[model samples]
Each structure stands twice: as C-alpha cells, then as structure tokens.
Target: MSDATAPQPFNKEIPTDEEGKFRGYAKARADFLHVRLVVAACGALIIYIPHSWHFALITVIAVCLAEALDTISLNQSIKRLNSGAPLRPELRFSLYTAAFQALLFSGVVIGGAILQPRVTIDMFLICYLFAAVMNAGMLLYFNSAATYLRLLIYGITMILIISMRWMYFAGAPVLAYETAATLLLAYIAFRVIDFVENNFREQEQDKVNALSRQKSMKTQLEVYANKERHLLQLAAVAKHANDSVIVFDKTGRITWVNDAFTEITEYPRDEAIGRRAGTILNGPMTSPETVAKIEHAAATHSPLRIEIQYYTKSGDPIWVETNLVPLPSSPEMDGGMIAIERNITNSKLRQSELANAMRNAERSERAKSEFLATTSHEIRTPMNSIVGLTDLLSEHDLDPAAREYVVALQDSAQSLVRIVNDILDLSKLEAGKLKITPSVFEPGHFFNKLDNLMRPRAEAKGLSLSIDLPDDLPLLYADEGRIRQILVNLIDNAIKFTRSGGVTVAVQGARIANTCRFSVDVTDSGIGISESGMRRLFGYYAQAEDTTSQKYGGTGLGLAISRHLAREMGGDLTAVSHEGQGSCFSLFLPIACTDQSLEGIEEVTQIPEAPTANLAERTILVAEDNATNRMLMSKFLEKCGAEIVFAEDGQQAVDLFCAKQPDLILMDMQMPIFDGVEATSRIRALDAPQPYIVALTANAQKDDRDRCLKSGMDDFLTKPVRKVELLDTIYKVLADRPMMEKPLS
Candidate 1:
C-alpha cells in the first residue's frame, strides 16, 4: 500500500474529526436498541388480552414513536459531535432514550388495562426478560470485555425473570429467579466504576509527562542563547584589545593572534599561523635573553616576563614588554603559551631623553656655582673700596653737599649687600647643604629681637608694624639663626610690598596631644598675588607678573628661602591671598621647652662700643686663599683694633697656629691643599690650649656650621663678612673665654 493509504498502528493513527461523530452515532444506536427492547417488553404485557391486537397495535405505535424520538435525539447528538461540540449531546440523547422507553412501556400497560389484566401481566413479565437481554447485549458491543460478560449475565437474568413470570403464572415458586437477577446486576455496576477510575488516573500521568518535557525544552533553549551571547562578547573584547596577543604551542608554532597582533606586526593571520614564533617576529634587535626566558617558561609550564626589541613588517624597531602565560593542558590538545605584548617604544625614548636632560641640568648647575663664586668675589672687591672711601670721607672735614653724597653711597652699598646676601642664602638652599640646629629659646625673647630689628624699617615706611605673641607659647626647637632669618625675610617682604595698610606679625601656640606647635602669621596689605601668579610664587626666582616687580625691585629669593628654611626646621609655610585684598602667610613649627641654665645666660643688653685705634696690641690670624680677600680682611681688622697675621689656606693656618699661638685663628672651608675641616682636626690634635678657632668661608650653608663645629672650631662666620658681624663675633668669643692666664708677677 502507498504510505498515504496504509493502515497505521492504533496509537500512531491521527484521530479524524469524524471519529467523535461516529462515536456519537454508535451511542445513539445503543440507546435506540435499549428503547426498542423496553418497548418489546411492554408489548408482551398486552399479548394475551381479549383486545390484544389493539393493545399490540398501540404498543407497536408507541414503540415506533419512541424509536423515532431516540433516532432524532441520536441524529442531533451526531450533528453536535460533527460540529465539534461537547459530549453532553450524547448524554442528552441517552436521557431522551430512557424517557421514550418509559413512555412506550406506559402506553402498552395502559392499553393492556383496557383489555385483559391477568394475561397482559403474564406477557409483560416474559417480554421484559427478553428486552433486558437485548439492552445488555447492545451495551456489551460498545463497552469492554467485562461489559460483554455483563450482557451474558443480563441474558441469564432475563431467563430467570421469564422463569419467575412463568412461576407466578403457573403457580410455581419465584424467589430463586428474582434473587439471581439482582446479584448479576450488582456485579456489572461494580465493574463499570472500576474502569472509569483507571481511565482518569492514566490521563493525569500523561499530563505530568507532557509538562515536564516542555520545561526541559525551555531550559535547553535558554542555555543555547546564553552561550551564543558570551561568545559574541568575547569576540568584541578580543577585537578591540590594545595589546598584541599571540598564542603558540610548546613546539613554538603560532596558533592564533588577535586583531592587535595583526595590526602591530603587519602580518595577516594566514601568514603568521603555523610559523615558529622566533622566525617571523624576532630580529637582530631582539635579545637572546628574552627568547631564553620564553623558552624556559614553556618548558616549566610557568609565566614569564621580558622586554625585547622587535622589528615590525615596516622594518621599524619597537620596544615591547611581553608576558608569556602557559595554557592549562587538556586531553584533546597539548599545553601552549599565550603571549601578550605591549609596545613601549615611546616611553623608552622619553626615558632616554630625560636622562640626557638631567646630565645637562647638572652641568648647568655647576657652571652657575662657578659664576656665583667669581661674581661674589669681584663684586665684594668694589664694594669694599666704596665702603672704605665712604668711611674715610665721613672722618674728613667736608661740606654738607659732599657728606650727603657720601651718605647716599653708603645707602646704596648697604642695599647691594642685602641683595648679595639673599643670593647666597638661595644658593646654599639649592645645593642641599643647608642644615638646622635646634636651640631652646623663649618665644617672648625671640619676638622681642624681631621687633627691635623690624620696628625701624616699618617706621621709616610710615606703616604700622605690630608683633603679637601668645602669653603661654612654649619655647621653640629650631635653629635660632635660621628662624630669625626666615622671620626677617617674611617681615621684610611684607614691609617692602605694602604701600598703605600696616603689616602685623602674630604668634600663637597649639597644643595637640603630646606636642606643642608654634605658629607665626604675617599679614600684610601688600599687592596680593593672583591665582595664576600664586601657583609659581614659591618657585625659585619666580616673581609676580604685575607692577610689583617693576615698582619694588627684589631678588625674588626671600620667600623661597623662607619656605625652604621653615620646612628644614620641621615646619611649613603657606600663604592665602586675594588679588586686590591683603595677604597672610603662616609658618607652623614644632615647639619644645627651654632648659633653665640656658635661660639664665644673660642676653646681650647692648651693642659694645668700638675699641680705640690700638691694633698694635691685638693679634688676628686670617685664613684666606684669595689674595684680594686676604688683603681686604687684614685692612678691615686693622681698622677694628687688631694686628693681622695671614695664612693662605686652612693647612697654613694650622701650621702657623702652633708657632704663633695667636689670640684667635681664622679658617677657610674650601681649600686646595687642605680643607678647613682637616686643618682644624690637626690643630685640635695638639696637646696645647685650644686656640679660639673661627670659620671664615665662602660656603655659608648651615652644613658649613656643622662641619666647623665637628672640626672643633669655636665659631662659624661666612666670608665677605660685614665689618660689624666680624667685629661682634671676635669680641664675643674673646669676652666668653676665661681670663687669659696671667704671666707670673
């Protein structure tokens, strides 16, 4: 048979729309059969009457009508099923069949009552037995094998009922037949209930299986979708990665390369794959050590990092930082390494350029030092002549006009000295030779000294200057000289910059936990710095880009030096300013307590009067390498009541010290033959009384002081020294010494 016409298995066949219609028709036929049987049984009730023919006719007519009604109901049910309506049509047909059967039976019984009652009753019982069998047989055809057995039992019940009817008519016992029929009916009812229960349970199991299959299908679809999305995201990341990525097997054969690798190497995927890693990429510039490291990583199954030079397809050498990570092994494939390389050529070039720039900067710094030294010497030489001439003029009798000119010269010389000092201080700070010496001093006493120094300058400018100190401020731990220099620089800057409003210096103490902090705030109505200017204000040699620099000339190193000094003394200086408003600069320093004995040391209450011209009695040893500086020092000391002895260098001074045993010895720090530190060491080694040793060196850094003290020098004094500083230092050292041993008298 062709596939379209072939007989299929019962389970495989597609249910036709006509199948339900056919079932409806079959049920209707069964109902009709039952009705005909019931009608025939009723006809038996009128069979023996005197008017039996009329009763039989009425019974036949009633039976025909019931069968016709049953047929109509069955046709309606079939029509409903064909239209895809509910099975309730079949149930209505069954009920109609039962109702029609009862009507037919009733017609027969009523018609029989008009004839003979006894014969009619006897006929009705026999017919009922046959009709019951026919009804049960029809039920058997449509239902199960059990239903067929029920039909046979119902046939036997009909026989017993017929027997019971005969027994009643023939005067025989009826109990046995009636009891047998009742038992058969009960068994059939029980079997029907069992079949219905089994059918529902099977339907429920099928539903559960269907639902489970649907859920499993949905889960598989979701997993597939997720996997597709993840693959797409990975492709995007690999395509856009900035670093070159290449995967290779342990045998060195390239397996894969990302888009960056292709772009960087200028090698297409087809050209690069299956080639040895070193063959295509590595060139003369590539390091053998780097290749060896990669080989070691592949052998040991570890990660490796190395920087190498590689030539691109365009023949440009690029520096690359490469990382090789070993892939985990799998059953289907051998382990390999994934190489991620980043081009660092630009960075490498920048580093080389920076190194060259640093060398140039160092050379420039050295040249600057030499220039400063030469310039300082030359300028001081002229300054000495000018000052000396001014002093000589003051002594000589002169007119008011001539004396005024001399006074003007003196003021200019003093300004030049201040500028030169600021430059020297800045140089010391830049050379990293500046050092801090912590000293215990009363805050009140320190402020008093600052006031004495600044009050005159403020009064000259006609600007109010006030110093405010907290009463409970603690002693400061700092280099006293450096602190004073920082304060003077800040205050001087405030005074010089301010034209109208006054300048104020306020001192306060902050107690935090175990430490006391001392702070100095300097507020001035100066031409304040702009936002753009403030950024570079603290920078070396930087000045405000306004009228301030043009109007009030300065070296621009004071604030920078002050900030450096403050930081060196374990503090910091910061400023707040507005363009048109005033400015406030604050200095924060850690404070300590003053020792009692040190406090008892009497303050110098007065500037000592200059001694008379009696240099014939006093001896001064000058240590100087420069011939001009040596001559200048001798002349200056000769005018200060001392006879001079000179040494060209530190070593000469040491040798002359033991022979002359002069009252005081001068030391120059930087010398060719022997530096001041070494000469002082030799001088200190002598078993004689330690002479008064003083450092007179061009190196004015605070480290110079430490070096001097370490060498057993009694005091430190910078070169190109003012006559006042030199004379004051000499007199103080002499006065501090115990009275010189008197000769035996």
Candidate 2:
C-alpha cells in the first residue's frame, strides 16, 4: 500500500509503462476539472452580450458534464490497467476524450469571436485557443496520441476562424498574411508538442534505468543489513564475555577490541585500538620464547595457545592464556588475527606458591629426618652405656637398695628408647615409608610371648595380667612384629593407667577360606577416656587428658603409632569405654591363614626367661667411638664368656680384626675414622676369616638398617643396645658358624 500524502517513488513494483500513463491521465483530468467551470464562466463573461447569461450557464453545465464523464472514463481505464489490461485501447480512449474537451473549448472561443468580431477580441480568442492547445499538450503529453489529437483539433479550429474572418472583413492580401501567420503558429504548437513528446520518451527511459538501479541497491542493502545483524550479534557476545577478544591486522596493529579486552588490559577502547597488542601488553618479565612462538604462529597464519606474562596499563604484571587464531581473508581486510585471552594471574600465583610449598615440605622432611638420625645416635651412645652397665651391676651381689636403683636406671633408659622409637615410627608412618614384612607365625605363641613380656610390668604395678588365647590357632601370615608392637602398646597403656584392677588379653579367631580374622581385646579396669578424648585418642602425641602425660609419664605417641601400624598391616584398632569404669581396646586383624606348619619352631607358650648368651672360646672385636659404650660392650662380652678385643674407632677395629681375626665384631656405625659401614666393607674385603659383623647404631630408620646390611654387615641393631641383645647376637653368630675353640687370650 502506498502513503496517500507522499508521492510514490518509481520502482518495479509499480507498472511504469501503463500504470504511470493511466495515473498521469487521471491527475491531469482532475487538475483540468478544478478550473473548467471557472474558465467557462470567465470566457462567457469576456464575450458577454445582452441576455446571454443562459449561454454562459449552458457552457458551465457542459463543462461540468464533460469533467464527470472524463472522470468516469479515467476510473474505468485505471481499473482495467490494474487488471493487466492492454495500454493501447486505454490510450486511444484518452485521446478521444481529450479531443472532445478541446473541441468544446474551441467552440467557446470561436463562438465568442463570431458573436463579438472586434479584431482585438478575435485576436484574443486566437491567442486563447493557442494557450489551450499548449496546456492540453503539456498535460496529455504522457500519451502522445492524446496530446497530438487535442493539438490538431485546436489547430484546425484556429485556422478556420482566421479564414472566415479574412473572407468576411479583409481583402485577399490580408487573408494571405493571417493564414500564413496562423500556419506559423500551428507549426510552433506542433513543434512544442514534438519537443514535449521527445522529452517524455527520454524521461520514461530514465525512469526505467532508475528502477533497475533501485532494485540493485535494494539487494545490496539487504545483504548489508544481514552482515550488520551478524556483526551486532558478535559484538554483543564479545562485549559480555569473560575472556578478552581482540582483532588486529597482519601487522599486529589492533583494529578492534571487546569490553573484556579493555577491562583485562586496564586500557580504554580508544587507547587500546590502533596500537600493537605486544607494545601495550608485553612487558619486561614476558618470556622471549613465548613471544617468539606467538609471532611465528601469526606469521605462518596458524593458531596457537600459550600462557605468557603481560603487564597492564598500570604496569602491573599478570599472566594470561591466549588463543591466537587467523581470520579468513576478506576484501576490506586481507589478513587479520583475533586473539581470545583469559587472565590466569591467580592460578599462576597459586602454582608458584604450591611449587614453593612442595619444595619447602621436602626440605623440612629431610631436615627432620637428619635431625632425628643425629639425635638418635647422640642419645643412644650414652644410653647403650647406661643399659649395659646397669645389666652388669645387676649381675653382682648387691644390696636391695642398690639393685632397686639399678633397676630404675634400666627402666628409665628403656623408656627413653621407647620414646625415640615411637617418634621414629610416627615419622616413618606419616612419611609413608614404614615397611610391614609379613611372616608365618603361630598366633598362640605370639600372644603367649606378648603376655609374658607385659606380665612383669603388670605385676610391678600390683595389677594381675592374664592372657586368654583360643585353643585352635591358625598359623597366621601377617606382620608379626607390627602386631606385637601394637598389642604391647595397648597392654602397656592398660597397665599404665590401672592401679588396683587387673588387665586381660582375650583373643578370638575366625577362619573363612584362607583368611583368618582375629579380635584381640586388651581390656583393663583403668581410667576410662571421655568422648572428646576418644575423638583425638589416635592423633599424634594425644593422650586421655592434658595432665595424663605429666601424671602417667608417657610420650603420648604409643596409640597413634599403634593405630598406624595396625592399619598398615590391613587391620584396625578401636576402643570402647565408659568413664570411671574401664576401657577395652580391641585389635582387629585380617590375617591370611596357612595350612603349613611352623618350620623350625618350638611351640613355647611363654618366651624363655633369658637367651643363652654362651660365647665361650669366642674372640669378639668391639669398635666404638664413645668410651663409656666401649667399656660397656667390653664388660658385657666378657661376662658372656667371650674374649673381647676393643678398638676406639673404625680404623683400629679393622686393624684388630686383621690381627686377631676375631670370631665376632660389634661395629658402632657412627664412629670416628670412617663409620662402621666402611670398616665392615674393608674387613669383609680381607682375604681372611670373615668375622660376623653386627651394626650397632641408634639411627633407627629402616634406610639406616638397609644401608648397614648393604655394606656387608651380617646384622643390624638399633641402640640402646641391651646387654642381652648384644650377647644374643654374639651367641647366635657363634652357634651358627660353629666357631673354632680359640683360647681366651
């Protein structure tokens, strides 16, 4: 639909040929009708005669009727043309109607001239006819046939009026001049019409060309509109995205950037655009290699993703992960690039901090390990002397008070060693380095031995200790040492807290398939722990109460180490108790059962009171750095019936072995003039009888033991080396080797 007020611009949608011609005719007729009655009245008045009002009135009526008829014809023609009717018939009708209107107007002029034949009036009438022809030609020129037909009617009427006047009033000479002038005027009118017709044809051709151009422009506009819509959508996404988006030319000059880009760089859009990204974002700390990688990717028209350090507008350094992609070539921009970048400053900082923390943790662990090793060696050197001398003292016929003191000294020394051992065990467990070596052993015998060991402590506290073991025990495949350690810790805690009530060790076993589940309950009528205390009971160095350590004298590490050991052996330790009643600590273990019997074993329900330390006719060499330990070892070996040769350091010990070829060597690992490991290596390298070498050191870490064995030592022991342990090692070695009866020198 077209706007009624605004003229419609020419386009293909409008039928430019027939429709335009029809509209032109309609419009011209409307314009002629607006003034037709006025023109008729003025002409009648201009040629007024007495009682000639009716003539004027008739002319007006006739003009009105002609206008109404022309309008009806025009409307019908327009409808037919809109219905796709042929243009030639409508144009011919238009020519006929226009000629009729021209004839009516020419009759008015010729009638006025005949009624009032003054030469001036006649000349005025001739001029009016000429004007009317010119007006008709101007209006109807869109249809050349209509314009020419109207022009011919008015031309013939003017020439007929001129000839009639000349024949009535003037001579033949005057007639010739008038006729010639009228023909000249006709010629001019025809020339004007021809000019207008030619111009209309040119204008119509221009309108067709304009219509074609307008169609092409409309297609281009639609394409541009679609492209603009896509661009707007892309802009909206980039504007709100979290990552920075940037577009730059092949020369690395930024052409566009999104809001995120400006926010990340702390640069405004106007300042950021038209500048090289590297110039603004890259800083002194930025890696040269990373920059080179980006440059190479860009130069090769390839995509790349990299993390690089960049500086903001304020010169603060940050890290970003950038994805650089090449843009497809376009006419407006031949080769360009777009970069999507994410800020990773916080992540990078966290990585750096984590790395630093890991390095620090490793260093701390190493330091802790070294400190423990050194402290163990330093403390145990004197502890060995204390325990050994106490054992030697007990052998004498001493008074009861002296014996009590010696026993106390021995207990204190043992307690110190337990604390050191607990600390080391906890460290190993926490460091994930504790080794659990499984072995086949009789569960009955194992519990019986633990019962024997803990009974003495129970009796000393005036508390009776009892062990209830299942009669049908399986040969359990498990880490016996670790299990015994946990039980010992549990029983020790039980007896330690109990004053009057006794402690009981109850063992229940269930066998299914090849696995045996054991529940060893160490219950005691002792001071029970509160719920809060139970919560932290298995934490490192945590006890039942704050004053528990002060009152009971413990390192508070036993239960923690015990629980760790139990779990390491595929088991768990739990406890249930009520305050003021008692606590029952249960040890659960899933040990694989074996059908095979214990090899080379005796079914001793109770451990022997003592190990037979008979080393008669044996020559032993002791290498020690500490003088007290050396004296202690000498007294212990001599008391065990073995002849002792002493050395102050590793070098002297090796010399003594070369000379005497002692049957056994007690090598103090951390000694002067190279440690026991080097001394043992040197002694083992000798082309002589190899002495049984036992490593004695307080560095109780498993690595120390492995290292000692690796250095050719026959056995490894952690101090404080009990006199019994030293003598047992010597006796076992002699028994195994069947030493020759070398005299006591």
Give per-model TM-scores.
Answer: 0.55, 0.63
* Cα lDDT of model 1 by residue, 1-745, tens digit: 0001111112222222334324633553544454454545444433533565655655566655655565566667667777888765465545546455444544344444334434535344433433443343333323234234434444454455444455555644444454455446445544643454344334435545666687888888888888889879877776678999888987878988899987888989899999977888889978898888877888888988888888887888888899888888899668888888998999899989999999999999878877776666566556655665566567779899997788768656766776777887778777876667776666677788789878767776789999988887655556777878888878888888888879999988876654678788999998887998889778878776556667887767778888988887778999999887878999888756554443343343235665443434456677777776676676667666655788887678877776666678778776759888898899889876667889877665455578789879888876556667677778776655543331233
Determine the C-alpha RMSD for candidate 1 after optimal superposition of all C-alphas: 14.1
| lDDT (Cα atoms) of all candidates against the true structure | 0.67, 0.78
Model 2 per-residue lDDT tens digits across residues 1-745: 0000112122233334655766775765654554655665565565544327877676656655655676678778888988988877887887677767667766776777677664557666676676666666665444557766766787788877886787677764666776677678768867875776666666767778887899989989999999999999888998889999999898889998888887888999999889988888888999999999998998999999999999999999989999999999888767889999999999998999999999999999999999989988888777877888888898999999998788778777777888888988878888889899987788867877787777877887789998998788788888888888888889888988887889998999999999999889999999898888888888887887888899989878899888888887888999998877889999998989988656534432223344465666678888888888877776766667777888888899888887777888878888888888899889889877677788888777889999899999988888877777666566656776867434345
Deviation (Å) of 480 in candidate 2: 0.7
Model 2, position 726, has a per-residue lDDT of 66
Summing lDDT over every window of 10 consecutive residues in candidate 1, give the lowest-scoring window.
1-10
Clashing pairs in 1: 44-123, 45-124
